[model samples]
Target: MGADLYRDGVARLEAGDGREATRLLEAALREAPGDVKVMHALSRALDAAGERERSVQLLELVHAKAPSEPEPACELAMALLERTEDTRAAEVLAPVLAAQPDHPGANLCMAMALAKTDPERAKAHLKPASRSADADQRAQAAALERVLSGQSPG
Candidate 1:
């Protein structure tokens, strides 16, 4: 039951129906309380629904519960970066970056967090991210690199 709801909720979220996704994911969470995966999905749904604060809160909870997990840490760090909490985001991402220096997502988040204050470090991280298998990650790294080099991303 919980797994079904979780899949359905994620499907709805992917379908661009954040409100419905949130509803379904909320029910899924209730059915499987303390499930970090459900919590992560709900966080994404909440963010998609424009409930940014709630989404960050949920991400924080997920990070706390799964501190050593790269996914949750990266998600929470990205959320913090969106809020301009660069230092905190870097702190959150430190362990993951340490464990997997070439992790595309972690490097991207770290690059974003350090871009303003430390362009050199940001560029260093971007080097690995630019070679990511994920096109979007590579694009973002390229864009950030352009910005750092004083060229417009366009």
Candidate 2:
């Protein structure tokens, strides 16, 4: 019912219109509180808008609601790492990787999660990430390789 607006909001978020997405998603959430998809999309919108902490909260709730789904786990893990909560990120991502090893985005994210604590191992995973068919995965893997080669990832 109300999810139509939420889905539209998600499309807006993906299109980089975070402000409009937030307004629409918030309106949807008000009507359909705790809808997992709505929460996930709105959380991503919040992250794109630079409201990182709030984004994490929305994603955490999503994870709680959908334990078997990997996207929210990936989102929360990256958000945690961005906030310097690497240990927590590892805790969340471990099961995800165990369940879906070939998920390119998850593997790339795992490599990033390991980069600060274990450079050599991260490089090994980053190699596969670079070869992944997904462009985003390849880009992340290449960025990691650049850093490992002693160049700035920037």
Model 1 ranges with Cα > 4 A deviation: none
Model 2 CA deviation exceeding 4 Å by range? 149-154
Q: What is the Cα root-mean-square deviation between model 1 and the actual structure? A: 1.6
What is the lDDT, from 0 to 100, of the residue 94 in candidate 2? 71
Q: Number of clashes in every candidate structure?
A: 0, 0
Question: In candidate 2, how many Å is residue 40 off?
Answer: 0.4
lDDT of 1: 0.92
Q: List, residue by residue over 43-141, the lDDT tens digit for candidate 1.
A: 999999999899989988988887757787888988787779999999998888888888998899899999999999999999889989999999999
Candidate 2 residue pairs in clash (backbone atoms < 3 Å): none
Candidate 2's clash total is: 0
Model 2, span 27-69: residue lDDT tens? 8998989888888888988888888888889888887787546
- Looking at candidate 1, the ten consecutive residues that score lowest on lDDT are 63-72
TM-score per candidate, chains pooled: 0.90, 0.80
- Kindly give the stretch of ten consecutive residues in candidate 2 with the minimal lDDT sum: 121-130
